[model samples]
Target: MEFTEPKAYTRSLIPFLDRSHSVAKPGFSRWLVPPAALCVHLCIGQAYAFSVFNLPMTRLIGVSQSAPGDWKLTELGWIFSIAMLFLGVSAAIFGRWVEEGGPRKAMFTAGILWAGGFMVSAIGIHLHQLWIIYFGYGVLGGCALGIGYISPVSTLMKWFPDRPGMATGMAIMGFGGGALIASPLSVWLMGKFASSTDVGVFNTFIVLGCAYFVFMMVGSMIVRVPAPGWKPEGYVPPATATKLITKNDVYVYDAIKTPQFWLIWTVLFLNTTAGIGVLGQASAMSQEMFPGHITPVAAAGLVGLMSLFNMGGRFSWASLSDFIGRKNTYFVYMCLGFALYITVPYAGGSGNVVLFVFCFLIIVSMYGGGFSTVPAYLKDMFGTRYVGAIHGILLTAWSAAGVAGPVLVNYIREYNVTHGVPKAQAYNTTMYIMAGLLVIGFIANFCVKAVDKRFHMKTDEDKDLGAARAPAGAAQAVPGRA
Candidate 1:
C-alpha cells in the first residue's frame, strides 16, 4: 500500500509554520515562549471545566425551552469521557508528529481542531443531535487537547534547560488554571446568551470556539523553537549529577522499553488516580459529609478553592523541583499525598470543614504538581531528544485515571451506601483505597533510577549531528544528546 504525501505547496508552507526552522531574531527572549504556550494551554484546559456544562446541557430543552427528551446526564458524561479517551489516544499517536512538525504547526493544528470542535458541537446542539456533539467536542476537541497540551512542553524544556521544572511548570500551570478562568467565563457566557426561549449553550459554544481559535492562533504565531544548539547564557550542567538525573538521550521508542519509564508511568498513574478520585466527588462529598454545615453554594465554593490550590501547586511545586530535583519532588507528592488521603476521612467524619478542605487542597496541589513536573522528570531520565513524545505516551496514564478515578470513587461510595453505611462515613473506604494507591505510587517512586547508559544515544552519530552542523559559537552551546 502507498500513502499520499502532502503536496509541494503544503510542504513549502510548513516551514512557515515550523518552529525549528524559524530564525530566532537577535535579542530574542526565551521568556516570551511561556506566554505563547500559556495561550494554547489555557484554552484547551477548559476540558476540566466541562462538568460546568453538564447540568445546563441536560436542561437544553425542558428546563427553560424546547421539546422534551433532549439529553441525559449519562449521555453527557460520555462526552467528557470520550474527550479524555481521545485526548490520550491522540497525544500518543500524534506525539511524534508534533515533534517532527514543530510547535507552530502542532499548535496551529490544535487550535483548528479544538476551536472547530466547539463550532461543530454548536451545530450539533442547534440541531439537537447527541452524536454530533460527541464527534465534535469529544473526538476532535479531545485530539486538540492532546496536541495542544504537549506542543509547548519540549520547547519550554529546551528553552529553559537549566530550569526545566520551572519552564514546564509555567505552561502546565496554565492548564490547571484554565478551568478556573473558563468555569466562570462559561457560566457568564451562557447566561449572557441564554433566554426563556433557549438555553443559549449553542451560541456560547460558537462564541467560545471562535474566541479560542483567535487566541490559540496568537500562540502559534508567537511560539518559536530555540536556535539549534542554543543554551542559556552562563548556565552550566552539573559535573556529577545525581542518580535520578541522566545526561543521556533515549529515543521515545527506547524510552518506553526502559524500566524507568514504566516506573514513572506508574507513579503518575497512581498520583492522578488518587487526586482525581477526590476531585470527581469534591462537591458531592462536601455536602454529604456535612449535610447541615455545607450548603450547595458552599460546596461549589469548596471546589473552586481546590482549583486555586491545584493551579498554585503546579507552579510552586514544579519550581521547587528545580532546587530539590524531580525525583525528590515526586517523593513529596506521594508521601504527603498518602498522609493527606488518610486524613480526609477523619476530617470529614469530624465535620471540620476547615480541616477537610485544607487536606483536599494540599492533595490537589500535589496533583497539579505531578502533572507539571513529569516532563522535566522525563527530561532528567531520558534527555530532551524525545521528551515530548515520551511525555505524550505517559499521558495515557492520565486518560486511564480519568476513567478509573471516578469509577473507583463512585463505586466504593455506592457500595458503602448499599451496605447501609452512613453518608458521612460512606466515603471512608474510598479514602483508604486512595491512600493505598498513594502507597503504591510511593513504592514506584522508590524504584525509579537513572536509565542505563547503554540506552543513551550517541551524540555524533544520532540526531544531535544537526546541532553540530550549526555555526561555531552556537555549536559549542548545544549540549550533547544523552
Candidate 2:
C-alpha cells in the first residue's frame, strides 16, 4: 500500500532556503543578480574598516584611555589577522561545497555566520574576553567572508558569460567599496551608543550584526541562478578561441595540478605582496614620507581616497580585462606597479607629495584590480564549470600576503629606523623591494600558458560530476536548469 507523507513533516521543511528555490525562470533579469551580490559583499567588506574598532576597544574599560586591563593594539591586531587566515582557509575547504550547493545556500550560511559572529563578539566584549571575540568574529565571521565572497562569483559569471570580467567586477567592487560605507556608519553607531562609562562597542556590534543580517538575507532572497544551457539572447560564442581562453571545462581538482595554476597563483601572490604592504601602512607612510605636507588628518583622508581608487579599480580594471585580455591585464598591473613602487621613494625624497600620492593611488588601484580580475582569469584558464572553487583555493595567496605584506612593511621600516635611517626615508628600501617583487610577478604572468589538454574533463559526466548534489525537484521547481 502507498502511504502519503504527513502534512506536519512536510511543513517542517523550509523549501525557500534550498538551491533549487533560487533558480531564475525564463526572462528573469540577470541585472538583478549583481545588486544581490553587492548585498553580501558590502557587508563582508566591513572587514576592511574593522581597524576603526581597535582604539575604542582598547579604551573600553578606561572609557577615554587605556586601562591596565584593556587589550593592547598588538593583541587586538590579531582579530583581523585571524579573520583573514580563516577567510582563505574556509574558502579553500568549503569551495567545492559552495560550488555544488549553489549560491543561495552558500549565502544563507554566510549571513548566519556573519551575523552570528558579530553577536558572539558582542557577548565577548560584554565579558571582556579577547579570545571569545577572536573565535566569534575572526573565525566564524571569516568563514562567512569566504563563503559570501565566492558565492556570487560563479553565478555572476554564468549569468554574463559574454562579459564575465565585467560581471564579477560589479560584484567584487562592492567588497572594496564596503569600507566607504562601513567606516562612517561604524563611527556614527559608536558615537550614538557612547556614554560616560560605556564605550559602546558591544551595542555597536549587536546593532551592526542585526543590520548586516537583514541586508544579506535580502541578497539571498533576490539572487537566482540561470537555467541550464541558458545564454543571453543574441549572444554569439567566440568562433575561434585563443590558446589562453579555453573553451573546454576542467575538473576542480585536476585544474590545481596544472603548472598554469601555480604560475597564475604566483602571479597573484607577488602582485598582492607588492601592494598590500603599502595599503596597510599608507597613512603612516604618507605622513613619514612627506612630513610637513601630509598631516595625520590628511593622511586619514589619503587612506579614504585610496579606498575609492581601490574600489574604482576593481570595476574599471576588470572590465578592461574583458576587452584587452586577462594576461595583458596582469602585464599592465605588474609593469605599471613596478614603475610606481620604484618611483615612490624618489617622490618622498624629493618632497613631491603630489607625485607620491599619485603613485600609491595607481598602485592600490592595481592591487584592487588584481583581486577582481582573477576569477575571470580562472574562468579563462580552467573554464567556468569550476572557476569558483578554483578561485577559492587561489585565495590562499591573499592569506599569505596578509601576513607577509604587513610583516615586511612593519619590520623593514623598524629595522631601518633602528639602524640610523631617518624616519622620512625608512620606507625607501621597502619600496625598491616591492618593485623587485613586481618583476617576479611579471615573469610569472609571462609563463602562464593555456591549461594542457590532459587537465580537461573528458566526459559530460565529469563536467557535471557533482550536479547530483543539488536538491531533488529543484530543476522542476525553477525554470532554470543550472
Candidate 3:
C-alpha cells in the first residue's frame, strides 16, 4: 500500500477524527458502519431512561424519602423537557453543519457534549442545584442528542442504497433499545452507591457520563462515509424513478419550503403526540385503569415490556417499509395505529389485561417505527443529498409532541378526575383524543404526493457538496464485504 507523508499542521493529531481523514479505504466492510452508529445511538438513547433518575434524585437530600430540601418532582420534570426542546432546536439549527461536516466530526462533538452533560449534571446533584442539571443534560446534552441522532442517517442510506430502511433501522434500533440497558444499569449503580446519607444520583451520573463518552468516541473513530457514486456489487440503479422516489436532490432550505415537508412534519407530530402521552403515563394509566390487578411492580414491568416493543418496532417496521414502500408503511402506521388507540379504552373497560397489553405493545411499536421509517420517507420524497439536514428540521415535530403529548394526557386526565370521573375512566377521553390524532395523521399521510421538480437541484455541484468524493484509487464500497 502507498502512504502519504503527514502534514505539519494536520486537522487533528489523531487524523481519523477529521471528516476528510475518516473515509473508508478500499475493501472496508460497510457492515462495520452500523456498530459504529450503534455506539453513539445506544449511548444517546439513555434519554428515554433518564426517568430512572427522577425518583432517586428526589431522595438525594433525604436519603430514604423526599426531604424538605430535596428537589421536587415537578422541578426535575423540566430537565427532560428542556433536553427534548433543545434537542429539536439544535437539530433544526445545526442540521446543515452536520451534513457538510461528516459523521465523524458530528459524532465527536456529540460525544463531548453528551459525556460532559453527564459530568456537569453530576456536579449539579452534588451541589444540590437544579438549573445546573438542566443546563448540563438539557442544553449541552440535548445538542449532543440532536447531532448524534442525524449524524449516521444519511451515511447509512448512501451505504445501503438498496435497503435504506433496514440500514437505518439497525442504527435507530440501538437508540430505542438504549433504555433497556440504561434503566437496569442505572438502578443497580444507584443501589451500589447508596448509603444512609446519599442516594447515589451524583455518582451514577458521573459513571454514566464517563462510560457514554468512551462509547461515543469509539463510534466516532470507526465511522466513515461512502465514496461518491459507490453502489453495492450487482446493484443496478433504478432506470426509471418512481413518482415519490426521485433521483434528483433538493437543497435543505428548499425542502423546508415544500408542502410535503410540513405534511410529514404534521404526520410525525400527531403520531408522536398520541403515543408519547400514553408512554409517559403508561405505569399510572395501567394501575388506575386496571386497579386491583396491575400493581406498581407489574405496571413497571409493563413499561419495560413496552420498551422492548419500542425497540423492536424501530427495526421491524423500518425493514418492512423497505418491502412495502415508505408511503404504504406509514399508511399502515396511521390506519392500524388509529384502530389500536380506539381499542385501548375498550380493553381497559372490559378488564382484559392481555388485550390492553397487546394494544399498547403494538401502539408503542408503531410510535418507534414512525421515528425510524421517517428518514427513509424523507429520502423518498426528497433526494438523499440534503436528507440529514431535512431530517433535522423534521425532528422539531418530536419536540412539539414531547410537550403536547404529556401535557394532554396529564391535564385531560386531571380535568376528568376533578370533575368526578372515576380514576378508572379518566383516560377514556384521552384514548379517544389519541385516536382522533391518528385520524389526522392518516389524512395528512393521504395528502402526501410527489414533490415538484422545480425544487430539485439542477447542477452536479449543487447535488453533492464535495463530501461524497472518493479517495484516489479506492475501490467502490460493497455492503458486508471485508
Candidate 4:
C-alpha cells in the first residue's frame, strides 16, 4: 500500500497528522524530541508490567466471581506470549511502512491500536472470552507495542547525530522504567475502581486505555522531524576513519543482506536471551537461592530494584557508547555479562545475597543498554536513511529471545531438578548456559566489520529515488556538505 495517500478514511488523515510539515523554528532544541518520544514510550512501556494483570485475569471467571471456571496460568501465559510474538512480527513487517509514514503518523496509529486493544480487551473481559482477550490485547496491542517501541528510535538518532546514543538512550530508558510507573499505578487504579460487583480490572483497562490515548496523542502532536540536512549548532561529524562508523546509506531491503546485520542480530539475540532468562526467574531465583533468608516479599522488592538498574543502564551505558564507540560498548556488555552469569552460581552457593543481587543488577542494566544503543549502532553501520526499518527487522531477535530465554532456563532447571539437584542449584546449569550464549555474542561482536561499498547507496539519484518513495517526513535529503 502507498504510504503517501491511503484511500481508507482513517489513513487519509495521515497527511494532516504529518508533523514534518511543521518547520522547526530557529534555535529549536532537539531536546524536546526525547521527552515527546518518552511520552509514548512511558505509556506503552506498560507492557512490561502486564504481569500485574495476570492474577486478576486468571480469577476473572473464578469461584470468587460469578462464572464457572478460572483461566489457568498457562492460558494466561499465551496472552503475553501472543502479544510478544506479534510485537516482533508487526515490527518486522511494518518497520519500513513506519519509516515511510513518519513518526507523527506512526505514533498516532500506534496510540489508536494500543488504546483500542485495551478497550477491546475490556469487552473481552466483560464477555469472558479468552480468544477475544487474545485478539484484543495479544494481536492488536502487540502490534501497537512493536510500532511504539521503534517509533522514536530513528527520529532521535537523526535529531542527535552528534550524540545518537544519548538521544535514543533517553527515550528507550522510559521503556525500562515503564513498569515502575505502571505496576503500582495499575494496582492502585484497580483498587480504586473495584467494588462488590466487580474486581475493577475491566474498569482499569478502560481508564488506562483512555488515559494512554491522550498521552500518546500529546507525543504525536508535539513530535517534529528535523528539516533536511539540519544539524545541531556547533556540532561536527567525527573525522576519524574507522570500521565502526560510516557516512553511507543502505536501503532497508539491502540491510538484511549484509553479514553485519545478522551478526548484530546474533549479538542481540544472545544478549537478550541471557538477560531475559535471568529476569524471568528473578523472584523465584532469589527465593530459591536463599531459601530461608529471602522472603517472597523481599524477592518481589528485588525484582523492582532490578528494574531501576535496567532503566539506569539504558542511559548510562548508551551515553558511554558515544565516547567508546558502539562495538566496544557491546564488548563490555558481552564480556562482563558472561562473567556476571558465571558468578551467579558462586554467589548463590555461598549465600551472598548482596553479591548475587548486584551481579544480576549489572547484567540487566547492560541488557537495557544493549537495546538503547543498537539504533545508534545501526546508524554507525548503515547510515540513518533506513535506520527505522533496519532497527525494526533487528527487533525480531528480541521476539525470538523473549521465547528462547525463558524456555531455555526453565528447561534446564527442570532437567536439573529431575536429576535430584536442589532448587537453588538448579539455576547453576542455566547460568552456565547463559554464559555460553554470551560467549557466542562476544564472538559475533568481535567479528563485526563495515558494510562493503557494494551495499552503499552511492549516488545522488539513488538517494533521491529512495526519499521520493517514502513520505515527506519519512525521507530527508542527505545532510548538506559542511
Q: Could you give the C-alpha RMSD of every candidate to the true structure, in order shown?
A: 5.3, 4.3, 4.7, 3.6
- What's the TM-score of every candidate structure? 0.92, 0.93, 0.92, 0.93
lDDT of 3 by residue, 311-367 (tens): 999999999999999889889998898888889889999999999999999999999
Q: What is the lDDT of residue 245 in candidate 2?
A: 96
- Expressed as tens digits, the lDDT of each residue in 1-482 for candidate 2 is 12222232223256676555676888899999999999999999999999999999999899989999999999999999899988999999888767756788889899999999999999999999999999999999999999999999999999998899999999999999888899999999999999999998999999999999999999999999887777899998888768899988776778888988899899899888887999989999999888889999999899989999999999999999999999999999999998899999999889998999999999999999999999999999998877888999999999888878988999999999999999999999999999999999999999999888878765656444433333342112212322
Tell me which of candidates 3 and 4 scores higher on lDDT: 3
Query: Considering TM-score, which of the candidate structures 2 and 3 is the better prediction for this target?
Result: 2
Worst 10 residues of 2 by lDDT: 473-482
lDDT of each: 0.86, 0.88, 0.88, 0.86
lDDT of 1 by residue, 1-482 (tens): 11222232135455678443443665789989999999999999899999888888988878573347878889899998899999999999888667656788889999999999999999999888999999999999999999999999998998998999999999999998888888889999999998877777998999999999999999999897776667788988788767878777777777889999999999999999999998879999989998989999999898888989999999999999999988889889988888888898888877788888889999999999999999999999998877898899999999988879999999999999999999989999999999899888989989998898777775656544433443332221222221
- Clash pairs detected, candidate 1: 248-482, 249-482
lDDT of 4 at 452: 92
| Top-lDDT candidate index | 2
Rate residue 47 of model 4 by lDDT.
Answer: 90
Segments in model 2 whose C-alpha atoms lie over 4 Å from true places: 1-13, 461-482
* Model 1 stretches with alpha carbons more than 4 Å out: 1-14, 63-66, 462-482
TM-score of 1: 0.92
Query: Which scores better on lDDT, 1 or 3?
Result: 3
